[model samples]
Target: MRRAIAGLLGAGLVVGALAGCAPAASDRPLVVVTTNILGDVVGELVGDQVEVMTLMRPDADPHSFEISAQEEARLRTADLLVSNGLGLEEGLQQHVDAAAAEGVPTVEAGDLITPLAYADGDAEGLDDPHLWTDPTRMVDVVAGLTDSLETALGDELDAGELAASSAAYTAELRALDAEMASAFAAIPEAQRALVTNHHVFGYLAARYDVAVIGAVVPSGTTLAAPSASDLDDLVSAIDRTGVRAIFADSSQPDRLAQVLADEAGVDVAVVDLFTESLSEPGEGAETYLQMMRTNTERIATGLSP
Candidate 1:
């Protein structure tokens, strides 16, 4: 009986040890991305290597989005955090700082791209934060995201997997850039002018040889409202330039665009484009490539006779 009791105790110890030392199931690292655009880019690079949670929903404005308590919890627990980082997430900085203070790895994709300075005096000495407007710049962002993911997953991820994915995605973006250039080429040079709600497409316009006559918002940021003089000047410019379309961000209210169009006395169509955010799933502009394509096509149609 004494021998049997000793054997039973030994068996219990063995079971407990085995339970503690059994091969743990491989769980992917959790990565939290602040903007939907960065989230999509990171998702493309990481693939299934990491679990990605996007804080901003589709078509949500990055400058004004508020994080919930649950989102803060997720951020706190996240192994990595990705963001645009050039004053893009205007309202979410405190939360990001909190996450950073906790020693979570964070990446700013925009830092990899060559930033353009704001042309207008309003954004004095500030570089334009909308690097995603250029496909070449997006390649830089993908590289940064790949590096961040590799750091997180290390040997668990297949060697060169991130590189392979980045190459494929970069090729697609290059093709997209070519396609956009061709589409924009179709518009008459005289009419190849854009009037957006804000100076969001300066890089894009420069790349495709389109002139940005004026913006409804006087500044690069959407938070700034256009003054009466600003509106009057824009109206005068539209009349002089004969611009056919006034494009607006789909995420923002179009009351200003409508008012400008009504006052301009020209055929000013309010073309909605995915400027700072992607559309929801199943929408035409869900992906970055899709968003660019949709916006270019709409711009072409609206500008053409």
Candidate 2:
């Protein structure tokens, strides 16, 4: 009778252990993305395969946006963490490090793309992390992310479906590249100069054959401040380049751009572009493709003869 009771107790223990090990809500593999642009791309690539949570806001500053405590905790549950490394996510590095220390697999998109250097002047030859400004470079990002998702979450996601989604999204990015080429070609050769709020347009200018005059903030990262001489130098460059317009980020304050334009003493138009971040839904630059297209149109119009 004691042996029979012991056997029953052993069976109950096995049942309880199996029940405890059953899937819970948190069992769903989560992907914690650092920036909204990457979030949008990952969403397109993975579709409904894995749960994706982006830490940054749609229009937040990538160089300085911080995640909340709850969001940091969410990082703990993530199977994969995708970030814009190479000093882009300046304010969120500590959290990313913490998450990685906690055993979350991390992928930095900047490592995948051939990063451009800050053209001339300050921080010249420093690796610029703003690869999204060039849609073709984003092709590399998409390819790397596809492989990363597979490596990180293949057990939880369907391999075939993920590949299909990634391929389709990459095709869309290529179409965006072709569209940008056509749009920028319409601008006169002499009028292809760019003066932005900051030095965030290196990749875009490099890819499209546009000459970057100079920037208000003359550095690759936005965290750096411009001095009085810096502003004066940019104004002189703007006047010399005969740049019709100075572009500023839609998400950032454009007072500096306006100041520089005013300082230039030319009829420089201050235009806004979705340069650094994506916009909210129903807005002009809500998606990555939409952001690139919208910027291309604005740039073409701004620099047109």
Candidate 3:
């Protein structure tokens, strides 16, 4: 009986030791990303190597989306925090700041590319945070992000895996860039004017040789309201440009775009694009690549004669 009790105790100790040795899902290196777009990109780059927590929900506005207390606490625990900087995360800046203060490593996609300023709008001259509109720029972001993850995660992440994944995704981005260029090149030069719900396509415009006639909101962020004069100015611009379609963000209400179209009185189409946020699965833009490709097709169709 004494020997049996000792044997049972020994087995229990062995089981406890094995349980302690196996890492829990939470024990994986945590990467807390701010926007769903960046989160998708990060997931592509890292695969199953880390736990990615995307703070912004699908179709949530990055400029105004808020996080709960649980998410705020989780931010401090992040091995690395990836964000779309350049004043884009207006509502979550405080939480990002707190996470950085706690010494969590951070990589901002805005810092990876040559940021464009709002050409015209109330936010003119401010850096545009919508750099992901251009796939070539996104290739740069993936490169920078891969480097950051390798440096921050160190032995916790496999650098070899990171490089392989980045290369594959970068190739896809280059293909996407070519695809967008080809599609937009088909738009008649005279008909290459774009009017969006907001000034969210400066990077896309610059990359594709399309003109941003103006935005209904006349601001860089959807959080800004359009005044009577702003809408009046945009309406006049649309009349002069003969814009065939006005693009509105799929994540935002298109009532303003509809109003602008009604006021334009020019049989203009109100096309929806996944501008800032990814849509829910099967709603067309579950990934960053999908979002860009969908927008490319929509824009090409909208502007083509």
Give the number of the best model, judged by TM-score.
3
Candidate 3 per-residue lDDT, tens place, 1-305, comes to 99999999999999999999987766679999999999999999999999999999999999999999999998998999999999999999999998898899999999998898877778889999999998889989999999999999999998888899999999999999999999999999999999999888888888999999888888888888999999999999999989999999998899999999999999999999999999999999999999999999999899988
Question: Could you tell me every candidate's TM-score relative to the true structure?
Answer: 0.89, 0.90, 0.92
The C-alpha stretches of model 1 lying farther than 4 A from their native spots are: 1-26
Misplaced by over 4 Å in model 3 are 1-25
Show pairs that collide, candidate 2: none
Per-residue lDDT tens digits for candidate 1, residues 193-252, read 989998888778878898888899968788888989999999999999998889999999
Q: For candidate 2, lDDT tens digit of each residue in 124-144?
A: 888898889888888899899
Clashing pairs in 3: none
TM-score of 3: 0.92
Which wins on TM-score, candidate 1 or candidate 3?
A: 3
Supply the TM-score for candidate 2. Answer: 0.90
Relative to the true structure, how large is the alpha-carbon lDDT of every model?
0.87, 0.88, 0.93
**Candidate 3 local Cα displacement, residue 21, angstroms:** 13
- Candidate 1 positional error at 45, Å: 1.5
RMSD of each: 4.4, 4.7, 3.6
